[model samples]
Target: MKCLKSLFPTLMICLIVFGCTNEDIDENTVNESSNKNYNSPNYPIKSTTELIVEYQSGFPERKKEDLRKKYNVKRYEKCDCTNSRIEKWEFDPRVDLEGRNELITQEGGIEGTDYQFFYDNENSTPGVSGSTAAGQSDLLISSYIKASNSGVTIAILDTGINLTRLPQSYPFLYGTNSDMTLCEEGEETEVSGWDFVNHDNDVYDDNGHGTVVTSIIIDKLFDEDISDYQILPVKAFNDLGKTTTFTLLCSYLYAVDKPSVSVINMSFGWYGPSGSLFPKFILENPDILHITSSGNDGINNDDNVHYPSSYTSNNILGIGSFSIKKRKEIVEPLPFDSRAMGISLLSPREIIKSTFSNFGVTSVDFLSVGDQVSFYDNNGNHYLVSGTSYAAPLVTAKAAMYYQNGHITPTAITEQLRLNGTLLAYYSLPIYYGDRIIE
Candidate 1:
């Protein structure tokens, strides 16, 4: 189950561990809908009003202040996620955004700014509405499904969770003391999770994506009568499914700080490189298992990189999608003449790659049934949605089951998957170690 190490020679070297600090953040309550206006980037290069800057280790505090003053940084705050290694700089309104981009590019960046980057979530189907109640799929069933005595926690980072719609029968959410309106704040020294999109403790799922994703994990656990696991809900994306790199990093720090959390289910991704310190954060926290979606772009990740999923961290496992129901159309017997037409044929293969799911022998480790999976909205109505987003939680649920069974480390759980997997080919293209249908 060890990943293909040759693909990432650079990451093989140990990374520098950033300095740590306890920085207090001033809570600013903002409307989730207000996030709709932030610059949405399909690629990280797209400009945004917000920028993240990481100062070199042992950099003088006075020099940092001088750089901010020169750039007219309207507001600056240290990221608690990096233990104060990076500062988020918001430019003054008087400075034109284009001018800011020009200055950063032309000057090679401010004196101490070692890295500058932006990040946001990209939905496969952004505004498309799902169909009304289609019956749930039976594709995700696994022998591993069963009740757990140990209370393993999985922090879901996406649009928040809607507790009001969660069924009372499934008492899986962390910190829910039989009160539906409790917001599920963390117990003991833990704060359930944070809502970085809105800058509040209320992690409510107004957009329904998080609710659907959570329901998938719950479904796997509930059907087998498992109820002891805790779900730490971290709202990183807003109602419109947009978020900043600062918020994404903040969510990771929050999840890692909690002692109970062992698994993090990230069902979203974007293409291109991000200059943020996310890879370093994942590298530093090696014990926690990070399950990321390989994305739904239908492109090969080896050619075009995807963040976190393609970061080559041994602890990170990328999950892609395959479908038994979706099929491909093929044309046989090529015609040579101009007036001739080839016979059209439909391939009956059941293990083809989900049309929209991204794949790479190096990046994606496994594939699950992702097409036409059933999920619920904020109002508790059922719908069939298809994406790598839905596919990831199946593996997350399986990982939790393994955790309960004493297969705690990422290496052990990955071995379990390798032993249980069924190798297959997608239209003659062999997938090395995936396409495991949990029957």
Candidate 2:
């Protein structure tokens, strides 16, 4: 060995550095850098990291400090939604029970329409308020191409879907991660999509926003062969109907990689940096089309910048609200343009406009009638709700139907949609998605 080393000194030096690398570890344990012994587990490998909160019973106040101390966390701020007011614009039609003139008790829909299924609860019960969506009427005409609706999945990244709310006929199968499945008591009640807020498998809806949003898709496509379509119910928000972008980000990552999930319906938005990590992920995975609601504040997103919607990613389609028909007494070239860009089927205001919907000339790409939109409620009942949240799923349903019809690529889906739309909100103001997408 000594003679060999002397003969080939440079070669011997290389042997010493490389050959003994793994052998230098503690006898029982292998060194981290050893290629020979190291198992090539796929990684940066994503996994959920939960903050363990432990405290004695009856110690309510101690929960915060205990978690901080245990996790060794520094400068912990509340992980709730930043602007609560902005994110929460969903309004039930029964806000003031007295002014129920817009309300109509129907055994079914209006005489000569196929919209009855869209407004029916589990049993087609009466007492559903508001009116039919003009966007629905517009899509029936404009987007003539009927995509293959088979196997198309849409992830509802909101307050999670209540499986109980769905009727037996609407046999939509939700996703389940056995490892991360959540529960209430001893047993796991509902093992469906992950609850990012509570960190469980019980992705049940508490606030009803998710149910309503999910129903929008069903209402539109139920007439078609929607048997094979999947709905990924991801619960990012909690019972309070509040959640942070971080929570949403976690759910966003989970849904992007799932099989057959090409569409995501995000009905909540606030002023946050969507250009950051979220858009990057969506950009990398261009196959998925993230359709987000252009909030309900009735403000211009060009200046204010509602997040997720305002994000300039082609894959991310931001939708504003508009009614199809003109509201009474309000005459303009841009008729039915709600506060944002509405075409009222019925008016919440002087005529009927989506009273609360954010608009943008540059940021928001498309507009749909969010005013007087009917969706299923949390209690297996149906009601009409008003907001851009309701409007967003209209685009998602179209995107899904488009995907079904062969517009699989995000660019193709968006471009084709834009080309079909007519101009709204002043001749050329609404751009990006051609004139006005849908109607």
lDDT of 2 by residue, 325-363 (tens): 422342333333344533222232221123355655567
| Native-to-model Cα distance after best TM-score fit, residue 97 in candidate 1, in Å | 11
TM-score, cand. 1 vs. native: 0.69
- Tens digits of per-residue lDDT, candidate 1, 1-439, equal 2254322222122212223222232322121112232222257544455566755557677877887787888888774323455677887656676656556544422332323444545542332223222211212111112233247889899887665554434445555223322222233121345567655555666666777788889888777566678788888887667776777776777777766788899988877764447887888888889998877667777777777778788888888887663234323432232223221222244455766677787888888867777654455555566777888898888888878889889888877765565544223424533434332
Go through the candidates in order and give the C-alpha RMSD of each one to the true structure.
Answer: 14.3, 27.3
- Model 2, position 25, has a per-residue lDDT of 21
- Candidate 1: RMSD to truth: 14.3
Point to the candidate with the largest TM-score.
1
Per-candidate local distance difference test: 0.62, 0.51
True-vs-predicted CA distance for residue 355, candidate 2, Å: 4.5
TM-scores for the candidates: 0.69, 0.57
